[model samples]
Target: MIRSGNPALKESTFLDLGTGAVVSRNAGAMTLNGTVNRTGILLLLCVLTATYTWNTALTPTGELAPGALLYILGGAIGGFILAMVTIFKKTWAPVTAPLYALAEGLFLGAISAMYEVKFNGIVLQAVLLTFGTLFALLMAYRSGWIKATENFKLGVVAATGGIALIYLATIVLGFFNINIPYIHESGLIGIAFSLFVVVVAALNLVLDFDFIETGVEQNAPKYMEWYAAFGLMVTLVWLYIEFLRLLSKLQSRN
Candidate 1:
């Protein structure tokens, strides 16, 4: 059984796809290469939309361009709704995944611009660190240096759940103007918190790798390639955001 920390990817995501049923003449089983190609397409879509919002966030005076907040809020909410839809209807991933990527790009671009404006070169640093960590972990997982053992998966999942609960509580408490102490501060504790979150986010990718491989081994439907890719993208987005926050916290200290 495959278990991942990503909410978008459950243990049964690829298992209940009528594995024993006859496949249509036009449909092919999921493959690693196919998922990789679809992931590339989704990433391209994200970069295209991100460029638009990144440019839009810039202005003549280097201040936030008009309607930047609109893009951020629209992207965040729209992406979230689309993600939920795709999670429930896996078949719709071919269409919804790209849309989710685009929406996320808008949100990421605006947020990155805001960070960049305050701390020069921070966005670039965050981007490089994000992808660097991704490739490093991919290599580690591929080389068998970082196996997704059952215990490891369980630990990561538990930690991820705890992190989610903390974030949820923080959001709820915001209504009362209550902050979670040093967790959001720029001090050592805040940086440490962000670093821990980033590590957990990175570890989630190993589970994602295991899940996608399981999907291929199970001979899931071709559309599942897109679904699996979507799941991976979800983790990557979360990792990138945490990297941004961590970098910002560090920059604030200097």
Candidate 2:
């Protein structure tokens, strides 16, 4: 069973793909090159939309443009719905994958802009750190220096799940006027927690690489290139957000 730390790239995701299936030529087969190209396309789309929302947030008038918040909320809600749609209907990825990228770009842009406003240049730092981590892990994974063994996958999956649950609990508690600034504060403990989350989030990228490679080896359908690209985007978004949060906490200490 091919496993990944990314929920979107679960164990059974590619189970039914490429098994004794008649694959067409190179173009019809899911190759690493094709997936990389698709990933680049998705990233371009995301960056384009994200730039729009980023500029809208910091309009020339020196204040947030009207409806900035609406875009953010729309992106968040729309992205979630579209993600669900893509997951259940993998064949629809060629259509929904780009849409998901655009939607997430909107959400990421608005939130990142807000963070930038509060902490100058934080967005750049997060972006650089995100890509830096991505390349670093990709290299390590390619070199077999960081193998995603069963135990490794399990540990990362558990860590990711725990972090998700903590955030869920925090949100649930917020409704009762309760808060856990313990993890949001700039103190050592909060910073420590954020660091841990970032590490786990980064580790997910390794699993993503492993998952994509496995898909290729399994001869997954050509469209699965898009699906795999989408999964990588999901992990990248999560890692970028975690980096932003960690940087914000550190900045607050200044």
Candidate 3:
């Protein structure tokens, strides 16, 4: 049975489902960095889109310009397509990963620009802190400092689901005047929530690692590499946004 804590599965490392080939545990295991490298081409596209959207603005003169809605739409559509591709691993990841990245880039850039106008400099700080957190999480994972256990997985998964529900509810509440307190600018509550989210996001990396390791061990198809990258990108995007929102909330209070 394919279970999370299968010892036999853990004993052997790195099986290519494409070829039914198995390699030593320490020999061919796919590392997170390696999977990222495989998807670098797609990531570059995302970066370009972000840069282009970041600079495209209405300026103080107020000429015709793409509004925040455009960025938000592009990001949403891209993310939807990305999820589709990830779920249908055979045909989507290879084709849509790059496009998804591009869309996200444009969205993040535009969002960052808007925030910059409102909060000034918080964007840069958020970016730096996001990367810092990513680096820290990766290092800790690699060093075996934070072991991924069944309980850890359940906690993060539950927290993530709760957060998603809250976000969706908040969005729906926008039309009714019932705002989600402590989410946007409720001071300490917002900060506490953000911190909890950050912790959950960081813990997601552990799940990501487990998936990668499991895939490699199970001999999942080669195309899964792109799918795996897509998953990582999704988590990273989430982490970045939470970081940005938390920073914005904190800055707004100051």
Candidate 4:
């Protein structure tokens, strides 16, 4: 059984979809190539929408335009809702997943532009590092250098859960005007914490890879290609955001 640290791509995601379901022979079973193709499509949609928000967030003077926050909030909240919908209604992924991507792109582009405005060239650095980590880990996983052992999956899942709890606590405490001390600061401990989160996020990609491969092997429904791609996109988005935060922290110190 394949297990992913990503909540969307759980171990049971592909189970039993192959056995007694109504599958169309002409539609074909899920394949790695199909998933890759759908992933590319979703990414293209994301990038296109992202460019819209990215441009909208800036003025000719290169200053942040007013009302950018509207776009950001809209994207964030809309994406969250669509993501929940897609998570529960996997069959609607062909429609909702792309919508989710577009919504998330708006959020990412706005946030990235804000980071770039403060720290010149930080967005490019974060983007390069994000994709670099992705390809490197993909190569490692393919080359058998990194195996998704049971223990590894368990550790990553646990670490991911802990990180989630930490972020949750931090958010909750924020209402009380309390902060998590150095965890969000630019101190050494904060940098270390960000670095650790980035590593765990990267490892989650390996689990995603394993899960997608398992889905293919299990003959999961063809629409699962889109769902699987959506799950991968979720991880990539999280990784990119973490990279942005880490790079910003590092740049602040310099």
What lDDT tens digits, residue by residue, belong to model 3 across residues 170-213?
Answer: 88999899988765674898888998887787678677767676
Question: Could you report the Cα RMSD, in angstroms, for every candidate shown?
Answer: 1.7, 2.0, 5.1, 1.7
TM-scores for the candidates: 0.96, 0.94, 0.82, 0.96
Full-model lDDT for every candidate: 0.90, 0.89, 0.68, 0.90
lDDT per residue (tens digit) for residues 78-122 in model 1: 999999999998889999999999999999888878888888898
- Model 2, position 107, has a per-residue lDDT of 92
Whose lDDT is higher: candidate 1's or candidate 2's?
A: 1
Better candidate by lDDT, 1 or 3: 1
lDDT of candidate 4 over 100-202, digit per residue (tens): 9999999988888888888989889988998999999999999999999999999999999999999999989999999989989999999999999999999
C-alpha-based local distance difference test score of model 2: 0.89
Weakest 10 consecutive residues of candidate 3 by summed lDDT: 1-10
Overlapping backbone residue pairs in candidate 2 total: 0
- Model 1 lDDT, residue 55, Cα: 92
Count of residue pairs whose backbone atoms collide, per candidate? 0, 0, 3, 0
Superposition error at 58 for model 2 (Å): 0.9
User: Of models 2 and 4, which has the larger TM-score?
Assistant: 4
Please list the residue runs of candidate 4 whose C-alpha ends up more than 4 Å from where it truly belongs after superposition.
16-27
What clash pairs does model 1 have?
Answer: none
